[model samples]
Target: MESLVIPVLILLIVGAAVLLVARAVGRRTAGATGAAAKTSRGTPSGDPVETAKAAAAKLTEDQHRRLYALIAQGQAMAAIKLYYEASGEGLRASRDAVGALAAHPQPFRSAAPKVPEHDDDDAPERFPYRYRAIASKGDVTREVSSNMLNDEIYGRIRTLARSGDTEAAATALTRHSDISMKQAREFIALLDD
Candidate 1:
């Protein structure tokens, strides 16, 4: 029993120390944004993602959408490179700036484990039905996938709206709405005409 107490106390102290350090660091950094990473608000200077976002604000709608889409793919660095390639920014600077933002990603919190309650059947009942907490990992994955797809679809739509002919934009929108490629050619024709 005495040995158990020492080990448990040591674990608690270590855990508390770690939490305090993480919180301190987190407080200094930007809150939960993939962009805005570089230096924390308390630290020295501005980061690349912020700079890119600023530059992006000046871009036409098509470029803007593509930039964000690539960002969603964990390719913030690639997005920066593409922009620099297409625009005047040099490759190294853009890549470095974007890559800095990508590294040291925001830590993710895993769902908490649920503890089940045991009810005595013979004893006096406090309530009615058994409230079982349910969580499906598949559901979480599906939801994330759906969100990603939606972001891509919107990004593509923005691109089409900004550059493609009216018929093409309409076709793209229609195709995206269906989640299939059916009638895409006809819609493309509409844009052409």
Candidate 2:
């Protein structure tokens, strides 16, 4: 038993060293290959949240307000059309953009950027509006609604979906909402469209 101690200690130190080296190599490789992977895989490079924020910035204050109003009213298709016409992006891209905006609400930023006056003086709770996402295939339909999901988080999920990482997207969806993996998959399937 005493003879076994030295070898076991050596093995533990070697294992820890190997793990540390592997993690360092993984970080280096991931940083070096991230852009290459995005380009090769046909996913847009750079931070998607910044990209989506830039896209949102293209909208004027009035257009931004109107878009949010449409989303708040739950007129998703109409909101998509509004964003399509406003952004001059393709239909599919517009759909994704609208979905992103809905999941993560952006306040209007203009030269002056006036805050829209609200009459609800009694309402104490502001921010974190619940957004609903609905997806259906064949006769099966699934809906996920959560206040925790925002445009930035949802944009990441959309990026995962666009990059053929449905499993990751589903995992993200499950993390953002109180849904099972199966339900998250169903919702993520709709996002790919």
Candidate 3:
């Protein structure tokens, strides 16, 4: 009975040590994972869209287009370089910004505040080349081609649509293209994303 007691006590001690070691390792691992998650999120709020928006706001329209083009072409290094140069930020910051931009696509938003007077304008400036804007919902697809519509104008229309100003977006679209109000509304509806 004495011999059995000694062995049982030793086994219990070893088991407790193993459990303690496992718990310590688990806590360390979980702490590391939490830190990594926070770093990867890149924002204190942990909202990827807001992070992307803030990063994108640092870029010009041309830079934004080129960066997204590079990303779309699967050229990560080029995108990072472009962002680094355009933003005048550190390489690490550029890399993180590019990652956030790629992960959550953001539309170009002008740094200047939008004027209500400009928004109320009924005429759209004519561009040298015809711009094509296409929108699709499910199986239905719509295309609007016009010399009066360019990237900037289309972007503004899309922004309006996304901001829940469907009437204004449709009005802008109708002014830019030959589409009627009803058709413009239908087209704007598909741009709600």
Q: Show the lowest summed lDDT stretch of 10 residues, model 3.
A: 37-46
Which residue runs does candidate 2 get wrong by more than 4 Å? 1-48, 111-193
Tell me, by TM-score, which candidate is best.
3
Task: Give per-model TM-scores.
Answer: 0.25, 0.34, 0.41
Best by lDDT: 3
CA lDDT scores, all candidates in order:
0.48, 0.76, 0.85
Evaluated at residue 89, the lDDT of candidate 3 is 68
Error of 3 at 169 (Å): 50
What lDDT tens digits, residue by residue, belong to model 2 across residues 95-156?
Answer: 76777788777777766567666432222223368867677778878788887566677788
Give the backbone clash total of model 1.
3
Q: In model 2, what are the clashing residue pairs, if there are any?
A: 104-150, 104-151
| Model 1 regions lying over 4 Å from their true place | 1-50, 96-193
lDDT tens readout by residue for model 3, 115-165:
555444646666799899999989999999999988888999999999999
